[model samples]
Target: MTAVDFEGFVERLATVAGEAVMPFFRTMIGVEDKGGLGKFDPVTAADRAGESAMRQLIKSTFPGHGIVGEEFGSENESAEYVWVLDPIDGTRGFITGLPTWGTLIGLLKGGVPVYGTMSQPFTKERFFGDGGSARCRGPHGERKLRTRACARLEDATLSSTSPRLFSGGDLVAFEALEDRTRHTRFGGDCYAYCMLAAGQIDLVVEVGLKPYDIVALIPVIEGAGGVITDWEGGPAAAGGRVIAAGDRRIHAAAMDLLRSAGA
Candidate 1:
C-alpha cells in the first residue's frame, strides 16, 4: 500500500476542523444521547456536521482513500490508506462550555496510524505528528513539542477522563494511580493526551476508547517524544484501553500500577 501525504493532509484537515467547529463553540444548541455508556455523554449536530465535512473533504480530495468516523460508519475500507475522524472528541465538554474538547484526524496506512492532528478551535491551539516528528501551531506560528522528563510516577502529574466509568479492575487500578501520582485531575477527553504531549500533564490513563479516539493521538504523543500503549503494553487500537505518558519511566510505572491491580 502506498503512503499518504502527511503534511498536506494535516493542513487540509485542520482547516476543515477549524471551520466546522468554530460556529458551534458556545452557541445554544440542544444535546441528545447517541447512547454509548450513558445519556449525559453524547454527540451533537456539531459532531455530525464536523465529521461530514471531513469525510467530504477526504472524498473530494483523495477519492481513493477510506474513512472511519465516529458519527458515521466506514467507507471504502479496502483502500490502502484510511482516515479516522472523531469530529468532536469531547462532546460533553463542548456541550458544557468547557474548552477542553478537540477535533481529531488520523491517517492509517495499512491499519497503523502514520499521521494525525488534533485541533482545539476555542483555544486556537493545534498539535500534529507524522513520520516521527510533531509540532504545535498557535498564534505565535509553530513550536516544537515534546513530553517532559518526569522520571517516576510518584513525581508525575496524572489525568483521566472520568473516575465514574472505571469498574472492577479498572477502578482498582485508578485508585492505585491516585495514591502514587503527585497530582491528579479529570475532565479531559483526547485533549488529555495533547496536554501530555505539551508536557503540561505527565500521565493519562484511560479506557473505553475507540481507534478514532486514540489512533490520532499515538503519533501526536509519541512524535512529541512520549509513550502510548494499552494497559498491557499493546497498541491502543480501536476499542482498547490506553495509558499514555510523557516519559517512558512514568509509562512503565503506570503500567505496573494497572497490572498490580489485576487490570
Candidate 2:
C-alpha cells in the first residue's frame, strides 16, 4: 500500500494507543526505573500498554509490516515497510501528569520516513505530515502547519527536553547555542518539535535520542518548511545530537556553533 493508503491505519494506531494510555494518566500507575544507578530512565505500565495495543493492531492488520517500538524490541524490522513507535514520547512528562507528552507514530518505506503523526490525546490534538505537507487538528480547530521564519539565531526561540540530558562536550555546545537564541525553554519532549512544526517555536536541539524518539518528527518538521539535521548537518533519522530550525539560515548557524564546540 502507498503512504496515503496507510494514513487511516496510522490514525487508528494513535487512537488505540491513546485509549490504552489515557486511563493511566494522572492515576497511580507504577513507574519502574529502566535506567540503572546513575540515570533515571523510567517506564510505566501505560507505556507498555499503549505499545502493546498498537503492536497487536499492526500485526493483525498488516502482518507483513515491521515494527520497532520503544517498549518492545523490533519484529520483522527489515521489511519493506516498517512502523516506528514511541507510545509515550515523553515518559518523564507523563509520569508527572503533564499533557506535554504524546504518542509518536512514524512510517518508514524503504528505510526512509514517509509519514508521521504526533497525537496528544489528553488535549485532543493530532499533528501529522507527509514529507511534503503537514497539518494539525485540535481544540483550536484544524489548520495547516507551517514553521515561522526566523533567519537569524538572535531572533530564534529554542527548546530542548532538558539541558540535563546534555553533558560534557554536548552540554558545552548546547549552552553556546542557547546563549545566542532569543529564548530557551526546557521540558517539552515531543511537544516541542510539534510546536516547531506549528510555527510556535523556531529551533529545537536535542541529544541522545533513539530512532523512535525522532523518526516521527522528521516529516512534521520537513513538511512545515523547516530543516532538521544532525550536528554535522547530516540526516537526523539516526538521532544523535540533532538540531532543527524553522529557517535554513538558522539551521546553518546552529550547525556552525555546534561544530565549533566539537559536538
Candidate 3:
C-alpha cells in the first residue's frame, strides 16, 4: 500500500543478485530442460541458487514484501510491495556460455514497476532505474542513461531473445519486423532492455513472456525515456507480448508487425 524506498532496496538487491550469479558464471555447470514446447529450453543450478539468494534477501530485509520469482513461486501475496525477479533472464543463452543473460529485479507497488535493476555478471554491466532517474554502472563508475532518439523503424536496430523462439503465426510478424529495422540481432534477455535504456538498441520485441520477464524492464526503459508495452499499446503486465523501443515511432512500427501477426 506504500511506496518502497527504492534507492536503498535497489542497491541491496543488485548486490545480492550480482554476488549470487557470479560464481556460477565462472564455473562450468550442467543444464536441464524444464518443459517448454520443445526439449531445448534449459535451466541451470545458477537459476535456482541465484533466485534463492534473492528470495532470502527479500524475506530478511523486508518481511512484509511480496516476491514473484521465475525459479520460485509467489510469496507473501497479501503484502502491498511486490518484487519481481528473474534470477537468470536468458537461461538458454546462459547455458550456452553466452554472456547476454542477466539477473532482473523489479520492485512493484500495486503491480506497477517503480524500481528495477538488471545486472550482468559476465559482462560487468549493471543498470538500475527508478522514478527519478536511471543509470548504468561499469568499470568507469555510474553514468546517466538515456534511450536513443531513433524516431523511425528503418533507422533503428532490432534485438530479441531469439527469432527461433517464435513459431507458427508468431514467425510471420518476426520476419516482417526484421524487414523494417535497419539491422537485427539475436540474444539478449532483460539485458536488451538495459541496452535500450542505455541507448544501445533501438527496439526489443519478444513474442512470449510472463509478468516476471517484462515487469523489471518497464521502469528501466521508461526511466531512460523509452516506451514499453504490449503490441496493442496496452499494459505490458496484462499481456505476454512486449515491445520496447527507444522512441515512440520505433515502438509503433514494431507494434504494427506484431499486430499483423495477431500477437
Scored by lDDT, the top model is: 2
Q: For each candidate, C-alpha RMSD in Å? A: 1.8, 0.9, 2.0
Ranking by lDDT: 2, 1, 3
Task: Output the worst ten-in-a-row residue range by lDDT, candidate 2.
Answer: 254-263
TM-score of 3: 0.92
Tell me model 1's lDDT, rounded to 2 decimals: 0.85
Q: Write the per-residue lDDT of candidate 2 for residues 206-261, one digit (tens) a residue.
A: 99999999999999999999999988888888788799888999999999998897
Per-candidate TM vs. native? 0.94, 0.98, 0.92
Residue pairs in collision within model 2: none
Q: What lDDT does candidate 2 reach at residue 201?
A: 95
In model 3, residue pairs whose N, Cα or C atoms come closer than 3 Å (at least 3 residues apart or on different chains), thus clashing, are none
RMSD of 3: 2.0
lDDT of each: 0.85, 0.93, 0.82
Highest TM-score, which number? Answer: 2
Model 3, span 7-43: residue lDDT tens: 6766677678778777777467888888777647678
Model 1: runs farther than 4 Å from truth? Answer: 1-4, 36-39
RMSD of 2: 0.9
